[model samples]
Target: MMASSNAIEGRHGDASPPKASINACLPCRKVKMKCVIATHAMECNRCVRKSLDCTFREHRRGRKPGTRLSHKSGSSISRKGRGDMSTAARSSPRRDRVSDFWADSEGLQPDSLLSHQAMRGKFSLQNILSTDHGGNIDGVATSRSVPPDDPILLGLINQQVAMGLFEYFMEKLNPYISQLDPLLHTFPYAREKSSFLFTTILSAASKYFRSELYPVLHDHAEKLYAECFRRGEKSTEIVQAIMILTYWKEPNDTRAWTSIGLAIRIGMDLGWHKLRKSARDHGGLPDPEWREIRNVERTFLVLFVYDRSLTLQTGKPWMIERNEFIESVESWGEESMANSNDHLLCSFVALRLLTGDAFDLLTPHRKSPLPRLNRLLTILQNRIEGWRKKWLGAVGPGNCHVFLVQFYGAHLQLQLFSLPLQDTNIPDMDGVGDIMPFWVSYQNSMAMLELVTKYFHFLYLAQDSVHVMTAYAAIFLIKILLSAPSTIVREIETPTIQAISDATKAFVSQCAPPGSSCTLQARFLEKALRDYSSPRNHQSRPLVYNETDNQCHGKDGQVSVPDSRVEGRESSILSGLDLCDQTQDVPDLLFGDDGSWADLFASTGFNIQEGVFFS
Candidate 1:
């Protein structure tokens, strides 16, 4: 398996020839042949013979990494790649502000924002800046009070304070997603590798913990981050730094997406995605080189998962093609098992893969009638159940926290297929039972609801509590309970909904200060749930509405199905994308890919049966 061919290209169109450089696609590169773009040339000669899509995309943006931005006085500097990053300062670093959501609280009721499409909840640079906690806070205020050239913010931290934050990052945050744990922990040794990466980690830590230093550290990170990429995008350290920065501040940090894009391109440049062949050819490469290569391969796999996670909801496009291999992930899993060091990362990868599958199986393009979709759902569910059993066995019983949070995430992404079905008002959807049992969908939904209920219980206990997936599950339950026809919602006893709702409210409040980006979205979702589950609405219906109705209902008893189902302003396009914290913003990536990641880690011992490949 190799990197996903169905990946999302960088901000520019598909092919970014490296700055002042020309390169061949992987196939041509492998053969050591020149890959030239002749007039009307799409595929390199080798790719055409192999019958593979000739997608030679890379992240070489308008200016290659390392090229300094040509700054203009008093104008917003157009940094290469997407340098769109920032956030407005609320009264307190932790307080919510109106500009964050780009609307006044007066006009925007939480219930309405959620019940109507959560357009404002979509991940955008605007949201990242408008809600960011950084300063000299120009990204948020857009005032340009400070020069973009300033990379150092005095008093950002001394060696002692820096260590405290680093400790916090290592202890509190690292355990949940530790792919780059080794690199992160050795920052003291690697700072010279890239100061931007070092500062970005601290900045992310400060933001994650909601330290007042978030603004200063973040500004320093933004300045140097641009510089790092400007120097060159191919340095493996740059990719690592981008991953760390993304994990530190995401969802609202759209700049992470740009960096993520660069990392993907750089991964391609180093041939990190398709390494098995490279390994065979580089016979003389030293053991240390192989180890480095393996790590690079793993990093690429993680990024591949991240891309799948994002596209699932935000409806963001992908760059990798469906035919790209995914063996890389498998290879890492196998290697990691020997040491037990990557047990958590394996779980993390597996959970996202399930979500990626769910996205592919359920996305509208399949035009898959309800019956076919149900069958796919069942098959995928069975696979997930297998993965869960294997994951628990691999992680062990003592590591209950890892097992539970990841499994909760699995339930959220897999069962999410039912939500779109529940909310979709497609007539003849009721006829779904003829092809397979209709109860299957409801059962799955109930399973998800139950997971949310389970998650609520574990929320207080799970260290490094992952909120985004939990939030997704919470909203899933709320949406079903709120809008689901009476019959289906009835199976969920009022007590269950009440408990879930109560738990959800507490969950939102818990995340408020030192908050996650999804807090407001959660609050809005909770409000919607409250409005729907209110005594008036519940009692207004005499008996459980029969599941016979194919239509998804609106506030009125009238059947109303939106044209696009649950596509817009709802979530990642591809679920527009998280792995760790950054990918969850695109966790849809962990959920779907063009098959490149599978190729990259193919020997990791996990593979979708050939018959199961969707699209």
Candidate 2:
């Protein structure tokens, strides 16, 4: 039913001699259509009809053999040069071409990585178009111009607070959350910068401001966050801002999850995740440019760690896959400023690795098990301990964030081991020894509770606790205490939990502009603790004396009898470890292996050694 070829061509039959189809012009290639250029035509038919110029541009070569080269690059010689007239000129061109091929060979590209990242839109040029800021920012076009408020006036009223707030984020929250640029010491040209980060910093710091100004500061932050996001400006600062705002969300709420994912997507488009490799390509860049590159790396690291931690927490599958840049976090070195909290970043990278591995070792969460649970746990603990030893050596007076993460990672190790506790099929009736070695995970849990106190003690002396870390520590401690026997809690540790709860409430009090997510989380945890400590929550019944009854019944129809004979709740921290039968007794050799470091701490008591930061 289709028209014959001659019939289709009747109108222009022999007007121009039939010419072989050449490579598609750039305009046609951009839209991915065929090119039809007559022998004498200067432009492709599509461009001729559309009244547009037909351009041809050289592209970077594709790596694979038989790779689809740009249409015009199909032959060894370009169309214009195909019939070379001069042999002497050809030889000179050949030498230059060979030299150019091997030039700038310092950087390495993993061929395997390209294909993998490609699926995630790694090489798309669409991001290149959007990265110019104007294309990205939507809705309100005013952002394309200067801010409505005069920069001079905005700075004047908030100068002292703004500078201190930026430092606060850099110090107190940044190490814990890891979002701010490490290089920028103060707010630099705020009116010209991305309002998102500026407002977010002010909003976060607003919680700590005097009550009179809290509402004003927080409102300003909220408006800017809304405007910047609603009208997206393509800048890396947008990514930074998204991360800080995510921290402001309630713990476990998916409200800000989407925003973070967007930030990561934009970050990848900006090639922030690939900054290290790209930076390596251009050696001898200025210090400011290098700092910008470092900022991207640091920001990407923060994004990676936060994304993974939340993934692990929620039992959701990971969004970003592991990559080489993340692995290089440990080996890469920086000449950090004095007390720059650089150790925290290094330790954090190491800690994130443990969590990434934790993702795999975790049952069902990971696809399959390679190293057995015991093997995995021992490896992780030893590695974490190694990390602690390294970071502790460098700990300054203001190292609370690093200290918290050390214990937090340790807690996560045990927490991973206890993942089976969540499996409904696994009975947790006489909880003490059923799921995991109750005494062991319990010790880590107890140790975590102690660490919470120490974490705050350090915060109180040096800096304030970040809401996210505090909430995480709160979640860890509460999970244990929700069912734990009141009697088993140390007389000393009990007061610490109370102190945490009290401090949380005090934080709640100062949380201005109302409904601050961190303060709300603190209030919720405080109430939960208050309920747990109520008189009615404690068990009053005497233990049954029946010979057949092996489990001791505790509060609210639960059992707390400690026994080491239990199986499957294996002592994965170290192999061949057996606990002393008594509930209160700890083993002489904590891991049953010689030189178990835990035993040294047990013997010496869990006290912070002089000049030692953390064990």
Q: How does each model score on TM-score?
A: 0.54, 0.56
Q: Rate the local accuracy (lDDT) of all candidates.
A: 0.44, 0.46
Off by over 4 Å in 2: 1-146, 149-161, 167-175, 249-254, 273-282, 335-339, 364-372, 424-437, 457-526, 533-538, 541-615
Judged by TM-score, which candidate is best? 2
Predicted candidate 1 versus true structure: per-residue lDDT over 1-615, tens digit per residue: 222222212112357524212334533432335454332334343333233323333322355333423433322211112221122222432222222222211123452222111122122345333333221210112232433332333555766777777676655555544545454246454444456656766776787564688888887777777776565434566677677766646334445446567778766654454433222232333444445555554566567666655554334765543223353344556653223435656565666665554665565555766566667667766776777677667774443344454445554444455534532432233554542323444344345444544545334323322443444444444444434455655566454444444444334433444244335334434343433433334244311221233222434554322112211233211121110111111011211233422431222111212101111
What would the per-residue lDDT of candidate 2 be over residues 472-506, giving only the tens digit for each residue?
Answer: 44444544443344454333234435444444433
Worst 10 residues of 2 by lDDT: 605-614
User: After superposing candidate 1, which stretches have Cα over 4 Å from the reference?
Assistant: 1-155, 183-185, 208-210, 230-233, 248-252, 255-257, 277-291, 321-325, 336-341, 348-373, 396-416, 419-466, 493-496, 505-522, 533-615
Determine which window of 10 residues in candidate 1 has minimal summed lDDT. 577-586
Pull out the clashing pairs in model 2.
137-232
Clashes of 2: 1
Q: How accurate is candidate 2 locally (lDDT)?
A: 0.46
